[model samples]
Target: MAEFLQRVQSVVWNRKLIRTAKGHYLGLGPEKTEVGDGTDGKPVYTLVGEAYVHGKMDGEAIDFQVENQILVEKFELE
Candidate 1:
């Protein structure tokens, strides 16, 4: 699971967001990803970063967090 999360985080960090509204956009982090359990007994992965609002378009910069995970009936390793 740790290895899987690392791979996923690497892919996400290499990507960037381009669309914008009023100069406000989300910027992903200096932080990495981790794994946990979800509400339905499934694996839940989380990624956290900074949220930026530019030029008085909104409030100050703040923490931005998101998750990516999968549910499985059985855990397997290749």
Candidate 2:
């Protein structure tokens, strides 16, 4: 691992996004999706989720907000 980092992408001293192992995770999108409970009761709001990891890098970041079970706002990465 040390030798590989020295030859490949190195973020710091010896840290790198390796290739020997594969990893992934679900990431929040730039929009906030919301789901509402339409039951025969009180009005309820639930935040919904869309696609997992976007078609970007592994360390991309996003922001989202939900209100009344609906996407209220979204923020872009600076």
Candidate 3:
């Protein structure tokens, strides 16, 4: 455990809102691929891993989206 802890680097959150047929989800992934362009002409991305944000995990993200006018985007895990 101590040896592994020494190899740790910086901690950063690359949070993103992902929308799919099932439901909306929050994830983190810095590395991604440019799949294609969306209807709005924005570049689509693919995330790698799922993340869990403590307080924002419940319905807080939804409220924030409503307040901030977050757009629904497409993301594929790779």
Candidate 4:
């Protein structure tokens, strides 16, 4: 999985949000994000950046991750 990880990482780093539809461990989402207090709850949206992946695995598995993503600033129903 090392090669798989490397390929994935490269794609993530360039973006502001990393999205993994099926294999999305450290994938894309708003819940796992860490918004700097200075950001002031703007609900950051990105096309690539660092992300969080939590399903049923430990942290040591993928110690470091880097990927890109498609982000949405907000979801509204009007």
Candidate 5:
């Protein structure tokens, strides 16, 4: 799963849009860094970003705010 995430990350790097099998699109938003504690009880730095989705609506693009992670989990690159 980590490998798949890495692949997806590489493909979507620099906020490039990628189309999925389900006719939806995926792209990175922006880079975000946060400080948090890790499993070792030490401060851990985390890099995070928002993933966006756009669904096709009657051949038009409709932006969707992803409230469920399952939508992204089902993405399969062909």
Candidate 6:
């Protein structure tokens, strides 16, 4: 991971631990939702910045949700 960081330009390390539905840890900035369309009816969330979600960084979230029959949810950030 250190080598990968070194190759990138303008990187900032910030720790804001967020827990997903399955209790997975996510290191990311807060997101906001604004009224918009073109999301195919799926609510669009405007990401404030970058994210580094462990385990679920790939397609694990989708698989987890599918296996556990978890429904998609959205929260309006204040």
User: How many pairs of residues collide in model 1?
Assistant: 0
Residue 59 in model 1: lDDT:
28
Which parts of model 2 have CA positions greater than 4 angstroms off?
Answer: 1-45, 62-78
Task: Give stretches of model 5 more than 4 Å off.
Answer: 16-53, 62-78
Tens digits of per-residue lDDT for model 1, 1-78: 999999987756644443243335443323332222123454553435443223323423212211223333455444
Candidate 2's displacement at residue 43, Å, is 16
Q: What is the C-alpha lDDT of each candidate?
A: 0.40, 0.36, 0.48, 0.47, 0.46, 0.57
Highest lDDT against the true fold, candidate: 6
**Could you tell me the lDDT of residue 77 within candidate 2?**
40
lDDT of 6 by residue, 28-78 (tens): 433432223124465654456655667876898799999999999767875
What's the true lDDT of residue 36 in model 2? 23
Q: What lDDT is reached at residue 55 by model 1?
A: 32
Better of 2 and 5 by lDDT: 5
Candidate 2 least-lDDT 10 residues? 13-22
- RMSD (Cα, Å) of model 6: 8.5
**lDDT score of residue 57 within candidate 2:** 48
TM-score order, best first, reads 6, 3, 5, 4, 1, 2
Better of 5 and 6 by lDDT: 6
**How far in Å is the alpha carbon of 25 misplaced in model 3?**
16
Highest TM-score: give the candidate number.
6
Q: List the residue pairs that clash in candidate 2.
A: none
The order by descending lDDT is 6, 3, 4, 5, 1, 2
Which parts of model 6 are misplaced by more than 4 Å? 1-5, 13-26, 30-47, 73-78
Pairs of residues at least 3 apart in sequence or in different chains that clash in candidate 5? none
What does the lDDT come to for candidate 1?
0.40
lDDT for each residue of candidate 4 in 1-78, tens digit (9 for 90 to 100): 999999988765544443344545544434344434224555554433334545524644434332234343446543
TM-score of each: 0.20, 0.15, 0.35, 0.23, 0.23, 0.41
